[model samples]
Target: MSGDVVVPAHNGVRRGRPPQTPEQADEVRARIELATAAVFTEHGSRGLSVARIIERAGISRPTFYRYFGNAEQPLHSLLTLSNEGLVGGIRDALARSFEPVQLGIAIIDAYLEWARGHGPMLRPVFAELHDPASPVSGYREEAFDDIRALVRAKFTELGRPLPSPLDLDTALQTCEYVVYRVSAAAHPGSEPDPADVTEARLTMIRSVLVTLGNRADVERALTVPGIFDERV
Candidate 1:
């Protein structure tokens, strides 16, 4: 045995097992995202820094970088997640075959609930999307597509042929934007009662859908089975 006998190296061993797969990496990403959202709420998304996020997440800088290239990546991912939740609700409301009026009401109610639940996330979305400087910044095409598919399904249910005309696109754009605006108004400082705002929103949406075509068909469609069964 030489005086410089080698000792087995245990230098890089982690205290616990590491996450093994991409799914685990995604899970870590999700945890970092949630922690980032909490931190953002306390210190606005724009104010969030990589060090602050890493500190809040209780993760090393390397761990943070593994999931998010920088602070903005997590913030953007969070916004996408938030938007996806809102889009899911829109899809649900559309699935329920309510009258044009009922559909509008359902959409408004669903959206309002989402805004109430995710108030912090909405602020950044609004700021980014509403800013003239940020073209294509806030709008998620995938999210809007989820909503459009739902509307298309309702149209199909009412035996309406899909129009190649831009009319349908215009109508959907109006309806979605109305909900977005109403939700922003309900965001805390607005004078309007959320309930009343929702009602007013639905009324406006109904008017638009009716103007496009088939108001009565919307009503009849709502009366059909599974629309309001509540069991769903």
Candidate 2:
């Protein structure tokens, strides 16, 4: 009785009470994808079940099946979202930056902002990145390739020298590590400490500057008036 999903259908069948339009279907699918991400992040893949997903999404089994074959179906979408969203954010940030220091900050801000929005979705992605059998096991490398291309182009545009390939690879990894570390420390659904955020951003900025040039570049970027804490 109470567990049954009652829908007043107009034209669609009981098992296919479809949305009025494709956009509505997309909205519903997004909700399920996010709920699946939350489930996976908190409970891992083994705990992923259609029941839990339906409960989290406040939808009937049929409704979920309408958009996804099963609970795990949304995981593929989430993987796409996790990787593409981060790369997309970074690419968009490139347009707003005009110089070396600004580029560093813009990219860092993009990453942290993405991390904040996808806080609950990062854990499952970490698992996927290391799993050899995952269909999208190459997702991380692909996303990195996209990011490196964007960074290389941005650097050339600003007349900045690109680091050796080895250096650039590690440098990009370092920035990602910084974001993951700081984001994990900050609780989702609450404001993080301003001081901690500044510290992490400055760390990313300094790491990039050091990689692009040397101590002189690092000092110059950090010394930009009012751009950083005076004590930093």
Candidate 3:
């Protein structure tokens, strides 16, 4: 008498048939990735092992390999997920406004909000990005480039030329400094409201623009050459 094989749902107990849907696979992968991130944050990425992930995730040992090829892949996914969420804020800021000063404020607010939302995942990613020896050290360079390209497009639309000493890379680095310092002050983990964070970020942005003499630079960067080109 042949029946069917069963798969476990919770606490390592078999309760259902095999997962056959893409959604199911994605859900499983997400759970495993989250578990891996939690463990890695506690143990460090290099210290994580397949056996430990299985133990931490409460899945079978082979289940770990079935989802992620190895520990590093899931760890990377977690970091990427954290970064993606942060980037989403930037994307939102861009969508919300074209005025450089407003956009700058939006960028700062978005960064602070992301930190408040994902402090656990971000702490390690932030630490790794700053540490030259960490595997993720070079990752932020690509992120910076992406952001600069975005800013460049905005500047071109505003009929402003890129300023001297404020090339794409330098601009990104400057933006990154704003994010890091604001995030540090916000202490998302302890903050009761994001108002203080937002206020602090606005003040910081004003100071940076004044000190760098970028107020005009920002205005020029956001000037649209044609009315037809404006989306909103």
Which is the leading candidate under TM-score? 2
lDDT of each: 0.65, 0.76, 0.64
Best by lDDT: 2
lDDT of 2 at 15: 59
Per-candidate TM equals 0.63, 0.77, 0.71
lDDT of 3 by residue, 168-229 (tens): 44545655665566555644445434665555565556544443336574455345342113
- The root-mean-square deviation over C-alpha atoms between each candidate and the true structure, in angstroms, is 6.7, 6.8, 8.9
How many times do residue backbones clash in model 1? 1
TM-score of 3: 0.71
Question: What's the residue-level lDDT of 219 in candidate 2?
Answer: 69
Question: Model 1: per-residue lDDT, tens digit, 24-105?
Answer: 8877787889788877766565677889888887889998887778887887777676677778887777778455556655
Tens-place lDDT per residue, model 2, 1-232, is 5698877665655655444698888888888987887788777766788899989989899889988897667987777787888899999999888867777778878887877776655545555566776634677788889998999898798777776789888877887778667656667544557788778888887777677656665667767864445672
Instruction: Using TM-score, rank the candidates from best to worst.
Output: 2, 3, 1
What residue runs in model 3 are displaced by over 4 Å at the alpha carbon? Answer: 1-19, 165-171, 174-196, 211-232
List candidate 2 stretches off by more than 4 Å: 1-19, 123-128, 133-137, 187-191, 214-216, 226-232
In lDDT terms, how accurate is model 1?
A: 0.65
